[model samples]
Target: MVTGGFVVDLNKPLVSQVGHLGEAYEEWVHRPIVTKESPRFFASDVLEFLTLTVWWAVPLIWLPVVCWFVSTAVQMGFPSRQVAVTMVCGIFVWTLLEYSLHRFLFHIKTKTYWGNTMHYLLHGCHHKHPMDGLRLVFPPAATLILLMAFWSLVKLLTPPSVARAFVGGGLLGYIMYDCTHYYLHHGKPTKGISSNLKRSHMNHHFRIQDKGFGITSSFWDKVFGTLPPTNPAEKSR
Candidate 1:
């Protein structure tokens, strides 16, 4: 009964209240959307897929480039292992953010003033649109501001090389998170880890809806006690 493109809960039976779109729209926001066999991504929907691709890839790759520049500056013409280590560390840091942010920010039902506003602006907007195409990834302006803040923190506490490396790693984690999220929601895999992730994410969208917030991994869900129950409210989608 969805109309004007809205997210629907698949776990629940279709009711008149749920308008426009169906469960699939909300569940797989990043995929080439189609309820009844739209064109394949490369063939018919190439333009849409390409836009989403560049949306996530640019920032993910840009972090490393920025890091390289910062690292060189911080090195002061010196070669050391710190730069390498920072790069490695930086990437891992992103994974943490992926797990944490997805769990805490995206899934939570904000109850407070600021929390609710932030939720709506950030994750809620996605839930609402889910397929606007341009809104899938974080805005570049927002990304730049975040990076600037991180860079300032790095400069204050760590060497430029180390900071850049750490930031680079974080960017990778974000890239993985964004790309993997998009794939899980849309691009179906033949099988393997990607498939597994897809299933987990699907469950999050269609089955539980309120739990299994972790996208890349469920490590934090368990830690934070947000993991879905074995027998979740079945009418969840």
Candidate 2:
């Protein structure tokens, strides 16, 4: 089925077609899904199109960068065990970072014109067009900027050895998070943890927006008291 500029497949199980409801947030979701592609702000159509679509390419692109960081640190004479431990710690730290960014930054409400525009561009677009496969994953351009910022932070805060290992693990965590998010939105999982994650994410989109902020793991949501109710009765309500 085609609506607005977006192509929707009737065979695919879409959780919601209804628009997002909120003050200053009425236009996007309510707007008809376009059957034709939306034009880009950028003059370069290829770059613009590439920015909107990201999937496996992002992780694959980052893998070499992550490896170089790790290997370079090891070459600087860091103990193998220490590097491993640091990397593990960085991965653990990523869960908190992911939860915090999704809950606070992405979900932030802005009243100003520019603020709202930026907000919509950053995340509200996702809520507005949830099934748009192209916009489902983070753009590699944006990811690179974040990587630079994070790399700088790690280097500044920790020793060179620890920084390298930390970046590697954090990169892995982010890749996993992005892949899992894409899977939950598009993949079919009849049972197990994958199924649960799909359900939780769907609920966040369609039912309880404030709760269930954790994507990589529900642990942070549980810890922060944001995990949405899971009981069958509660879900029906």
Candidate 3:
């Protein structure tokens, strides 16, 4: 039962827990949140559909931008090799950032009203509704914000030539991470790295939330001691 936007666990009784919000804990974890029907967000059907489907366009849209930035960096007096190396380092850096955000930011626990709301908005929604096809990918608005912040930070700290190459490479890495994440959720890969990633991600979603934070690569998870243990059943399959 819901009262004042909070789900009440009937057995527990609202009177027994006076100060605490009566929101059902199980609902947050197990229920599929129908975004279209939520009055709180006032989400439009068209917008929800677009956000879910925008992953297909991300590579096409960003690849050209990345290429242009790299080319412009080369023209700005940076050695081609140095630009390439810097770009590769940027990609490497993104993996760690991804892991950190997933583990620390997205999955952060909170007791306050606003903090829990923010967590649900950012990531808990995905965990609760994993098969919601439209919700699997990052929406363009959020992506643009992240990209702008990263690019600005890179530019602020480095020479223009180096910053351009770094930002371009980081963007490329981010695009790959998002795409790979979507694929792990929706694609069928029977063998090799894709299969491995898919399995680990499923484990993260269903069995263990604290482990397997890396979606694009397990290297960081291994480094941070958060890698999910290999189950014997998974090994035979």
Computed on alpha carbons, the lDDT of every model, listed in order, comes to: 0.56, 0.74, 0.74
What value does the lDDT take at residue 100 in candidate 2?
96
The C-alpha RMSD of each candidate to the native structure, in angstroms, is 8.2, 6.3, 6.1
Which of candidates 1 and 3 is the stronger one according to lDDT? Answer: 3
- Supply the TM-score for candidate 2: 0.81
lDDT tens digits by residue: candidate 1, 1-237:
233365445434322222233333333333323232222222335433442334565556575665575466466643556656666676566666666667666766544445544554466545544444455566555566766776687679876555666676666566566666666656769798777667766666545666677777767768877666656444543
What lDDT does candidate 3 reach at residue 125? Answer: 62
Per-model TM-score on C-alpha atoms:
0.63, 0.81, 0.80
- How well does candidate 2 match the true structure, expressed as C-alpha RMSD? 6.3
User: Per-residue lDDT for 1-237 in model 2, tens only?
Assistant: 444344534343232221222243434433434332332323555755665766788677888888887898899998888888888888888889999999999988765546655676677667756766677788888888888898999889998888999999898888888889988877999998999889998888876777888887899999988888886357522
Candidate 1 ranges with C-alpha deviation above 4 Å: 1-82, 111-118, 222-237
Instruction: Give the per-residue Cα lDDT of candidate 1 at 100.
Output: 67
Model 1 earns a TM-score of 0.63
The true-versus-predicted C-alpha distance at residue 22 of model 2, in Å, is: 9.9
Which lDDT value does model 1 have at 108?
64
Tell me how candidate 2 scores on lDDT: 0.74
